[model samples]
Target: MAESTLGGGAQAASTSLKNPRTAAAVRLGLAWLIVGALVALAFSLHETPNRGAAASFSLLIGVALGVTFQRGRFCFFCIFRDFIENRDSSGLFAVLSALAVGGIGYAIVFGAFMPNPSGRGLPANAHIGPVSWVLVAGGLAFGVGMALSGACISGHLYRLGEGYTRAPLALFGSLVGFGVGFLTWHTLYVEAISVAPLAWLPKTLGYGGSLALHLALLSLIAALLLRHLPELPAQAGGKLTWRRIYQAVFVTRWNPLVTGALVGLIGTFAYLRVSPLGVTSQLSSLTRTALNNAGWLGDRLVGLDGFAGCAARVVDTITNNGILIGGLVAGSLAMALFTNRFQLSRLTVRGALTALLGGALMGWGAMVSLGCTVGTLLSGISAFALSGWLFGAAVFAGVWLGIKLRLHA
Candidate 1:
């Protein structure tokens, strides 16, 4: 059996190498195209109406994130569901690794920003929001929406690049949900969030202390999860080589751990260079802009600008958020094509409807919570915000209930 397996593996490798010239040409062409497009985008941003290096930088960050996500399959909803339904903790471990890496990065960043971590002054513009009932409700709704739509907002973005038919409908529903969230934002803000507590771990523990405690906690969690790491059936001889390395890194799926670490690094770099990692910020802005233009959303709700969250503001020009989202799609598309993974999808009526409804839930949940899984749960935890943990638990619970209800079944 071992000999046969080795023979088969060698045959496959030889077949792949047979068309080396064509494969190399295709790969190089794709690489050049990606680089050219990025350069063009940067130049265009410089010459455009909202001319700034920031927008270009934001797009670059998005591209990195998109590539990482597509390559890693880093879907929060999927991670939770995989664990809940199949006891597959690999995806969950990826998520934890990302949080751990991001936490360390954020701690260093925060320390640099505010020398006195325990001082009354907080790190500027961290996503630490009030832990309110609305947050719980929003998280629950977001998770449910993820189950229905088959992905989260970030998931939909990258999947859309891969020709996922449901992504469009889900994203469209998210827009509508944002509109709904806008209509009720004033009440929620005034009634629930305004009076809620903002608990930042660094405020209590200080920067060094918070880093130590969180690292310890993360180490413990990682150790526990390590016991459950999937053990593949003992294979015959499968020797690693340079060709295999290329396939593993580019043509084949990356390890979740490596993907998570890359994601964490991207998130950290994004915060340091541009803004925190988020997808729905652009969606909310688009919704607000549309409503404002339609005269449905008046200046009365404009007070959201003062808040710390991914608040909406209507503008005619393209925003950094838009650039980020556009880059995500473009990056994913490029990667998919290069890897021969791009394909069009056609969805059934039921699937389409499910995606739309799920998207709407996600939008509403994001509006209430002021972020999605990426922005709220991941980034929040990285920033040492208690709301991140709370929102994350709520999202997990929602996913659990959704699976229990047989949403995926």
Candidate 2:
């Protein structure tokens, strides 16, 4: 009787596996399991001597970032494309929201860290870069690359987890571009970057003035963008339940403001704890290390190491950025799977070529500029660096050109 009952249970399990609903349930279960494992790994890393708590925190933050990026559709290129192509400025507001929130948070943190804003010394590890034509050129290249590749560097990283087949090619192209940047670093540095002025808003305007100006600028942008935004659909009113909550949190794309605010909070915490929110340091480091090892790159990259957006360096083990990236991918993958959004697509030759070309341009631009959108633009602007505004403007112009040329096609 016991054997017969066991046989019946096994048969039922097999039948459930064959059912589509059951299979989906199984997939969700697996995703949850993986997420659990990631959390456990973070804890374990905290206890480990080599990795330490910082690595653990970075991993967790990365996971949060990945989830946010995926849910919010926080790709800068996507945001710009939507506005340029569809005249939908909703996403732009998200970007503004993030910047505003981050700026305010940064201001408080800056005050605590440095009592006097009008000082000769800059805040430690802020994204303040020298304002120069070199920066403009880099930003333009980065923007064009985004259009060609169909995503920014951070976008590609998160999208990679969603089974974006072109991500690998784009990323590889970036590595090559980084290599090229390393080759040309000395000349650019000596010619322009060395003499360029580092413009920090607080250096001249003081914290209060800087924050006011930042908020005012964002508000103006927001007001201008209002004309482009489509009328939002009226939300259906209903009793809130666990299922509704689940759908709102996991199934639907998040509201832009909510998404931006969360992103702002994450960036703030990231800066307060580990470092500023940049994604390219590890990629650059890897590229630099590879080139140096191959004897193609010199030991010193001129004044490259001095300015701090996302400083790349040679390293034996995975750095905090690396860990963050890992968590980002993993988190995105889990979310994708849970949402039934993970699907592998076939890559055509034309698609592959464009991705590679675009990636290369982006890589070169990021290398030259010392960061990409997240680093130089978002983080830099949050820190009130004029270079951030310059880079952002150039990137916008580049994207516009790319769109006009139909490069994304």
Candidate 3:
């Protein structure tokens, strides 16, 4: 009787596996096969990417990063929360580890690829040109707003794609922040931006030394990760194993470091193709154009003339305008459908308004500081830019304070 029951159970399991509705695994397997073919096709193309193609490559990298980040549930805010609230270091380790790798990679690339590493590096935009006190203040404001909004600038974008009903409001607030940024740009140019201290890695220590330092830092972060891993209370039926650890490390998709590096590569390509690693300028330029068309302010800002002109070449795809924006939305939406996690949920009215306010602050911060968390902090840090570090420090402080104030609590 026992043997017969065991056989029946095996038969049921087999039947379930053969069900037509069980399409996910089949689809995933087919995707891998197609990916293999596409990779082969790319290799067959047999042409080294020029600067222009490299820039396009960067866009593709950004797309990959977006997909990875979405699937991994990786975010700076979550990283900090993991440490502060949950006593978990995995998320933070992921960020710092990625930073270390990306930082070293940037140093090597810049040191080797650039005509003059001491000056601006290969892509003129990659330079950590200078630092200003205003950056510290701006960073602080942005951090505070991010906490209150319950999302950062990039956070809102990704979350928006995840069906966060409040994300749009947050983004709208960010636009207003950009407007505020425009209002303050003139003062910033004179009082803050021009005199900000220029940061150069080679000047402080030679390229090789800096790269070594970055690698060492990465090792230290990994060590910290080992020591500080959180002990999550197991779910009622959960069993821990190598597979579970693997799932935790990689989640359902790509790693954050790879995504970030790909983003950096895309930045590298962007430098070769059109402009720098920036999103605000293009958006700001668009804002300027719209306002001008409405008989609003023009000839007032540095970026306005270009948007007003809408010159096809520069105004088109140069900045973070097109690819990052579109790819993030697309990646998130696609992942949602794939994972069966799509849902539209609204926050409290207060929370919704807070998101908007926070978003506005982020936009303003990005505008005044010349970029947002991704552009200014992540990309900037990887490039060894002083502004990036300062911005990071400031943002962290602000988040701490915001939490203390219970803004998002």
Candidate 4:
């Protein structure tokens, strides 16, 4: 939580970017070109190994996203931090802007064209899936835990991408927590999610009505956030200010809205290529595999599919598994290289343990609730699910309580 850590990284990354050194720029340009070429080639190779192409594409995307995320230091936890501790709204603006862009895009794609990935019937949109008591409880727990852990699931990924040694500890704990969640999956589904009512904007209000409502709500939140930001002083590092706030929302330099939209578009295109956006499930799947290999889980989880429940398996496969999670790590690494600051972080035992505990809570809470903040909150909102809004509200409340308790401090 030291501003210096966030501050130093940015100055370092920026200074490197602005460096007049020809050799460094050449290196960066080459890397970007290589990544781009690979993407093109991968898409063109209709006859090549399809699965490998998907994985490779995913890995490449991850690399790029990681670098951007690490260098940009964009994160949900920080957004909330600015709001709770600093009363700044820049971070929130980034989120809203991204959602705004994404919403407009999705409205065009799903609302009108109704083209499926293959130009088939429109893919089943999940603005909000079934909502239940479990969602509220689980989301609240995950949000509070994120504050304590200093990051949410996605936040942890970006930190790890930046070479934060503590992040892997949190990730490992998340794996264990996922395992525990799987063990309890039966009770959770039978008593909670299975019985939950599926919420959708299409049913209550037409798609047009739903989209308008969402846009207005998010816009209102953004306006309220704007009002709170002026109270904060601009810090050289991570502090929020009106200028930075404007930059976050309006500046094309690195708008969160644009970033999130690109991610959404990529996710949508990824659905074209392989799947929709998803992150935690793949990790959970990977964890399930590891646990099964270790004889910890039996056949119950082996080859089990959440696809039936999620209904966007292809998007989930590509977005969650390949892009978001991998993109984070890749984004950070790419950024570090540009900055010439690629080094593993060192951390105290206490810090490591704290991350681990926090990760466990996040992983478990996410599973019990059926998604993380990004998956459940952001994506769900774009889909215009009432549950998504509720989950987001719960997250804010939890963050507030955590800040009040000074858990982050």
- In terms of TM-score, the best-performing candidate is 2
Comparing 2 and 4 on lDDT, the stronger one: 2
User: Each prediction's Cα lDDT score?
Assistant: 0.82, 0.89, 0.61, 0.63
Worst 10 residues of 4 by lDDT: 307-316
Identify the runs in model 2 with alpha carbons over 4 angstroms from their true place: 1-19
- Candidate number with the higher lDDT (2 or 3): 2
lDDT of 2 at 63: 96
- Give the TM-scores of the predictions, in the order they appear: 0.89, 0.94, 0.74, 0.76
- Candidate 2 lDDT over 205-313, as tens digits, reads 9999999999999999999999998888678898999978988778888889989988888988888888899999999999999888999887898898898877678
Candidate 2 minimal-lDDT segment of 10 residues: 1-10
User: TM-score of predicted model 2?
Assistant: 0.94
Q: Which runs of model 4 end up more than 4 angstroms from their true locations?
A: 1-48, 52-57, 60-64, 112-122, 125-127, 231-264, 271-273, 301-324, 340-343
Best by lDDT: 2
Clashes within 3 Å, all models in order: 0, 0, 7, 25
Q: Per-residue CA lDDT of candidate 1, range 1-409, in tens?
A: 1112212233344346335544445555775698689779877886776557788888888888888888888888788888888788889878888998999899888877888877785678788878989999999998888888888999999888788889999999999999999998989888987788888998888888888888898889888877677874453468988877777767767788889888889889888877888888888988999998899988667446765667677877668988889889878877776665666787899999989999999999998888898889988989998988899988888888888997755
Tell me the deviation in Å of residue 369 in model 1.
0.6
Q: Predict model 1's lDDT versus the native.
A: 0.82
Report the lDDT of model 3 for residue 168: 85
Q: Write the per-residue lDDT of candidate 3 for residues 1-409, one digit (tens) a residue.
A: 1112212233234346343334344433444553454344334423544324443444454455556567766566766656656667767665675567567667656655674655533345563534788778888888888887877766666677678787788888877777777667767777766666666566566677666776676678678676777554455456888876655443445554555555555555544444445545555556545555666554566532222111112233344355456556555655554553445775788988888898888777766666766677766777766677788889888887887787877
**Superposition TM-score, candidate 3 onto the true structure:** 0.74
Give model 1's clash tally.
0
Ranking by lDDT: 2, 1, 4, 3
